[model samples]
Target chain A: MQWETVIGLEVHVQLATQSKIFSGSANKFGAEPNTQANVVDLALPGTLPVVNTEALTLAIKFGLAIGAEICTHSVFDRKNYFYPDSPKGYQTTQMDYPIVGPGELEIELANGTKKSIRIHHAHLEEDAGKSLHEAFHGSTGIDLNRAGTPLIEIVSEPDMSGPAEAVAFAKKLHSLVTNIGITDGEMSQGSMRFDVNISIRPVGETTLGTRTETKNLNSFKFMEDAINQEVERQIEVLESGGTIAQETRLYNGDTGLSRPMRSKEEANDYRYFPCPDLLPIIIDKSTIEAIRATLPELPEAKKARFIADYQLSEYDADALSSETKLASYFETCAKTSDDAKLSANWVMGDVSGLLNKNDMHISACPISAENLGALITRIKDGSISGKIAKQVFESMWAGEGDADTIIDAKGLKQNSDEAALESMIDEVIANNPKQVENYRAAEADKRKKMTGFFVGQIMKASKGQANPGLVNKLLAKKLNG
Target chain B: MHSKQLFFTSIGLVKPFELVLEQTMSVTKDDIAKVAKLARIQIDAEQVPEITHGINEILSLVDKMQQADTTHVKPLANPHDATQRLRADEVTAINERDKLMANAPESDSGLFLVPKVIE
Candidate 1:
């Protein structure tokens, strides 16, 4: 029986701020434990949470970006819970009224399918401290530095059906948050965290099945795998005449299965009530629109614009617009050389491959945009063959300046001279008499592929400097008749 | 499953004692105990009776929330709705070791002191 896996995600993005949400303490990441803890962070007697104006503004920026309904008046709720990670016994969060409500984000599946994940609401809350185990001696240590940090948790509607869509949604959220300069969206640093709600239903059943929420799966791949594994587990249980119990499960990365942790509970489990300390936040239309004005062009709009403006392939445009830095770099290069397709092709194909292989970001790329544009222009002008241009790019990777200097230093100029390439083409033809006879006798379609082999030989004999177009013309003449 | 009349119904049709004895519709004690364990809070068996009662009360509240046609209602995650105000990207302060460590239970030589960290 086919089972549809229903999935939704709750992502918490640590807002990029300099101070703790309610306190004046510096919101630095790597400070000593408890050192960054101010009186308010410690929740000392008489310490009150003064709402950070900057944090509120950041939340508004997100609301506008996603086209969410910005609530003019929202109240903070105290969610009472006990955990070592939570410095305060209760977390100050939004329960009754959230700041941003009902928006949609578009995610592209792994199979190149695109879907929109409907957002329920996004609200600002304080992050709990980190419970560091095995970081010190045998005992666990608490880092209050992260405590009271401002975070915006974006919750999604249960609109996704599989892990691929869930991953796409997460990635889309990551790009949106980072592009808006709201959060770093670093999954590795626990900067962005995900809680996945998963359930399995029969192929055509409309009524929702019981859902188990798996919390804190940081990596995108693991989150996707965990959802798939949990869906399979739920299906097996249902098929065996058992019903899914609404529960919280733990995803063991080692075993690649979710073990039942405990049954899930209603929100009142924490006895959620309005927080008394902070007052209701009232935002005006002008305030929200003002923040909207500052928002960078979002990923979807940017992707569409890149396609039309740069005349880039959808794949190339999508890949380039995955991050702001790469999109900016590609745009800068295109502006310099007016070669959008070339810029998109190079950034997506070569530059991205290099960065991923080295585990680096585009901002840290060794090659600058201007230099890359110069390299593309060289390839365009036939100053170098595409193969030799790759060699110059590798030299630039080693800290060499632009294309011309690298090409000059390495003698990578294309052998565009017709006589020189024609002689090499003759040598290729002389060496392969039998293949040439077959190529001359074969059908038109068959001869087309064989021409490539002759071109390869001529390009190789010329030490990768043979201009490909000239080499192809000469090889075709030498092969036919 | 038999739908037992709940004790705390809007209409007083059933007795509270009969409601506790009836195990047809509501969640069982075993499930509540399991949920408490999953929540990582230690609840004594003697407290199970009270915890189960509390859970039932909360579940009923959730049922009420679910009754509200929330298909159109957006689930809220944050309370403050506006762009987060940002500061100019710059670092302005450094840690003052003595001042920071002043609140430590024990300290010496600008570092917080704890009993025998390692042998």
Candidate 2:
């Protein structure tokens, strides 16, 4: 029986606030275990929490960016659960009234088709701390540095069908959040986490099937892999006379396997109640409009502008404008080089390749955008060949000086001088007499292909500095003459 | 609901009344045991009936209070009727780990050590 996979994603984005959501404690990563945890974060007796204004502002900013209805009044609720990471024994979160109401995110699939994923809602919550099991003897070590960190959990409707759609939605959401400067978007540092709910039913079945949630997947690749793995497992179970269990599962990316979290399955009841310690957050209309004004150029808007202003292809504009930093980088490079298409190609191809090879983000790229633009500018002019510009780019990436300096020092300039290229073509034509004779006798198409031999010889003689375009024009003129 | 109406009236908002109270709400010994377990509170089996009876009485009082119609009243998240005050995003908390860890039963390497929790 054919089965269709139904999936939804719950994305938890840690807001980039200077302090914790409800306390003045530092919300920094990689801090000493409990150094950043304050009395409020530790949930000490006689202590109370004060909401951070910046956290609320950031959440509102995100809501505005997504065209979601900003909840004028939202309340915090306590999700009762017993865990070492939660010092309060109850996670302070938004239950019924979330901050952001229904919104839609349009994602571009690989087939160049657009699909809108409906976001159910986004809520503000405080993050739990870390539980380190290793490096302790028969005990778990609890670090409260991350406790009280502000997070906006964006819940999506079960609109996605398969892994690709899920991944595309995740990537699009990541780009959107990062571009709006809400989260650092460092998936490695757990700034953003994903909980994917997957279920399967017969292809034509209208009713929903029991779903299993794979929790805490940090990376897109893992989300995709986990979705595929869970979907396959559910199908196998249903096909072999077994029912799919509705439980939370953990996906170990290392082993490429998922297993049910037995502890979580037994304790599924998170009795939530409105928190009495804090009052409802009431946002005014002026404040919402102010935050909306501060909303940066979102990815979609930037992509449209890139297409309209820079005249970039839809694909190129989408790739370049996906991230704010990359879009600005491409813009600077294109403007400096006076060629948008070339800059787009170089940024998307060679520069991205280098960044991926070194496992570095575009922000940490060693080559400055202006420097790359200078190199491309040299190629645009007759100063250097595209091939030599690549060599120069490597040198620039290696901390060498600018394009002009590298070309002058290495003597890698393109010999585009008409007299020089003509003489080199003449030398190649004289040396390859038989080939030249055959070229003169051959048909137009075959003779056009024979120019490569002379061009190669002349480039070799000129030490690869001879201009290929000029050499081709002069070679055809001299050979055919 | 009576207490809620009183609280709202005290805050200068009068709630309209249409009395409809459900007296079926009651607690059982098993429910008491479950609540006790959930709260991680120890309760002897002999005391379950007494606790359940006590809870049922309180619930009866609550049911009587529920007679007050509060359909027009907004759900009161806090009794004070005050919105949350926002603080500036500044880190004023110092590294009080050494001072705070003094209260812990066991701590090592700046981490609070608890009984092994394997998941």
Candidate 3:
């Protein structure tokens, strides 16, 4: 029996704010436990929560970037659960109305086909604290420093059919959020987390099957692996006449296995009610307009601009404009080197390969854009051959001086001077008298192939600094004569 | 009855107490037990009847208020019609871990320790 998989992603993005969502505590990562927790974050008696203006503004900024409808009048509600991570008995979240409404994101598949995924909504909420299970005998340690961090939970419709589309959507969303400057987009630090909902059914069935949610997958590879594992597990169970249970499961990235979280079974009933301590938030039209004005140049717009301004190919423009740092680097390099095509090739080829090898980001690249541009300029102006420029690039990466300094110090300049190249070609012809006589006596086709022998001799005489193009031209003129 | 009427009146519910007393509202002992378990509270079996009766009385009062014509009324999130106050995003709180951990029953290494709550 053929089965089709359905998937949806709920992504939690931590907003880049200076303080907690509803408190004045510091919202930094890797602080000592409980140090950033204050009276309101701790949920002390007689302490009330006041919303942070920057959190709301950033949330609106995201909504505008996605072209979603902004709910001017939104309210907070209480989600009651019992856990050590939550000091209060309930979590404050948006239930009925959220800041962002239904929107859509377009993703390009590997086949170059575009598909639109619908975004259900995004809401503002406070994050829960951390629960440390290790270093304690028969007890759990709770750290409340992360209890009240501001987050916007982006919920998507179950529009994906397989792991590839899901990964594509995830990458597109990551680029979009980071480009807009709302979140730090750091998956390792838990700034952006994904929860994948996967279910499978007969290929032609319209109604959905029972879905299990794999929660808190931080990396794109893990998300793809978890989805594939869960889908296989579901198909196996159904084929054996077993049913899939609707529960939340934890994906162990190290072992590549998932199991149902036992603690979440009985804790599912989140009795929700409007939070009375905080009133409704009514944003004005002018405020939305003001936030819309602050939206930066998003990924699609930047890609288009890169193509138009740099005269780059569609593929090269897409690759360079996906990240803000790489886009700026390419622009500077292209402008300085005066060659967009060559700049694109070097940036996407050698530079990217080096970054991947060193496990570093483009921002940490040792070869500065200006130095790389200077190297490219040397290649274009015949100061150094393209092959030799690579050597210069390596030296520059090793903290050696720029292209001009390295070229001068190593005496690696191309011998493009016509007079010098002709003397070297004349010497090659005189030394290889038999080859020149054979070339002059042979037909045009055989004579054309015989020119390589003379060029090789001339290049060997010049110690590889001799320009191959000039050697070929001069050798043909001397040997034919 | 007067106190019940005033309780509804104070929250802006204009229902009379006698109307609630006439209605037949009930809370079973099993319902009380279930609620107590959900709240993680310990309750004695002998106190079940009294607690059930007290809960039934409160439910009747709520039922009377629910009968009011509120078709055009919006759900009141807060008592006052004021909007939520916004705070500037500034880190004004400092590390008070020592003073705050003093309130915990058991703490070690700047963490609040509780009975093992493993998942």
Using all chains and alpha carbons, the TM-scores for the candidates as numbered come to 0.76, 0.94, 0.90
What's the ranking of the predictions by DockQ, best on top? 2, 3, 1
Q: Across residues A1-481, which tens digit of lDDT does each residue of candidate 1 receive?
A: 8889899889998988888788777876777667777667767678787777778888888988888899887777777665655656689888668888889887777677778789999988999986545445544555567888899899999999888888888888888888888887777888899999998888899998999989888888889888888888888899999998887877777777777664322333664655656766778889887888898898888989988887888888777887888889999888876788888778888998999999999999999998898889888888987778888999899888688998888788887899888778778888998988888889999889878788777767888888888777777777774
Per-residue lDDT of A1-481 in model 3, one digit per residue for the tens?
Answer: 9999999999999999999999999999999899999988889999999999999999998888888999999988777677889998788998778889999899998898899999999999999999899999989999999999999999999999999999999999989888888888889999999999999999999999999999999999999999999999999999999999998999998998999988534577565667777898999999999999989899999999988988898999999988888888988898899999999999999999999999888999998888889899999998888888888888888988988999999999999899988888877777777887788999998887877787778778887788888788777777776
lDDT of 3 at A177: 88
lDDT for position A298 in model 2: 91
* Native contacts matched by each model: 0.01, 0.84, 0.77
Off by over 4 Å in 3: A263-266, A427-443, A446-464, B1-31
Q: What is the per-residue lDDT of model 2 for residues A4-117, given as tens digits with 9 covering 90 to 100?
A: 999999999999999999999998898878999999999999999899999999998888887899999998887877888898878999988899999999988878789999
Candidate 2 chain B worst ten-residue window by lDDT: B10-19
| Residue A106 lDDT, candidate 2, scale 0-100 | 91
Instruction: Tell me the deviation in Å of residue A350 in model 2.
Output: 0.7
Better candidate by lDDT, 2 or 3: 2
* Model 1 lDDT at residue B25: 42
Chain B TM per candidate, please?
0.44, 0.77, 0.72
**Global lDDT scores for all candidate models:** 0.76, 0.87, 0.86
State the weakest 10-residue window (summed lDDT) of model 1 chain A: A262-271
Best by lDDT: 2
Error of 2 at A302 (Å): 1.8
Candidate that beats the other on lDDT, 1 or 3, i.e. the better one: 3
